[model samples]
Target: MTIFTLSLFSNPLYSQVAVIVHATNQQALTESDIKNLFTGKLKSFPDGNPVIVLNLPEGDPNQSLFNQKVLGRSDAQVKAFWSKLMFTGKGTPPKEVTAEEMIKLVSENPSTIGIVDSAAVSDKVRVLIQH
Candidate 1:
């Protein structure tokens, strides 16, 4: 399959996504862990390693799918959620990156977690969740 790195400008294609971590990452993530990671609730892995989270732009298909299926939030809701957290100084949001950058970032950072189209799963990263 092709490595899925479609630009964020593209329309939502309803494709599945894989939540990935660095290949050396050995965490067995629960659904709660996935949600907490994306939602800014869980800031670090259980071992106290900082969990650096990444995201595709809001309109990206994989971003939408992951937010809906995993985080149970729409783009608007997610935006507002982060906004409130930022304003309240409660939490910081994931950095928005292009799909290609996401793969590159996760590949390079053992502490990072990112979402990409399922078809994009590669040797550079390991899938923690697929939907």
Candidate 2:
């Protein structure tokens, strides 16, 4: 029999995740920028291109963390917020997607921004911000 050791620290999945956007998006985004984009406050990038915000499905761990830490809203709060906006005809909610789907969407659309675990980042996508 052989014994193997695996350190938690060595696991890449255990590493901290970085919030990313397309590098072509020259606008340096602050935490507020990210929040505003997702919440539909700021619709255009600094250069005036339409900005698209992608989000994970509700109840996802990363989505929950991102909502709490980045957007400063609980699941219910976000729901209510979107409801108000939609009913008012002011704005539409961001596109919701699975973690895997978001990765593909953000990468393919330069105007789109989405959050993903750092471990999932690939050469096909540009990681503009890591927060």
On lDDT, the candidate that comes out on top is: 1
- What's the TM-score of every candidate structure? 0.87, 0.79
Cα displacement (angstroms), candidate 2, residue 61, comes to: 1.0
Residues 1-131, candidate 2: write the lDDT tens digits.
22333656454435444566664555677778778898999998778889888888877767766777777888889989999999999999888887788777876778888878777887657775553
- Whole-model Cα lDDT per candidate? 0.89, 0.76
Give the runs in model 1 whose Cα sits over 4 Å from its true position. 1-14
RMSD over all Cα atoms, model 1: 5.8
lDDT of 1 by residue, 9-43 (tens): 35455567999999999998898998998898899
What is the lDDT, from 0 to 100, of the residue 33 in candidate 1?
A: 92
Per-residue error at 128 for model 1, in Å? 0.3
Give candidate 2 misplaced runs (Cα > 4 Å): 1-17
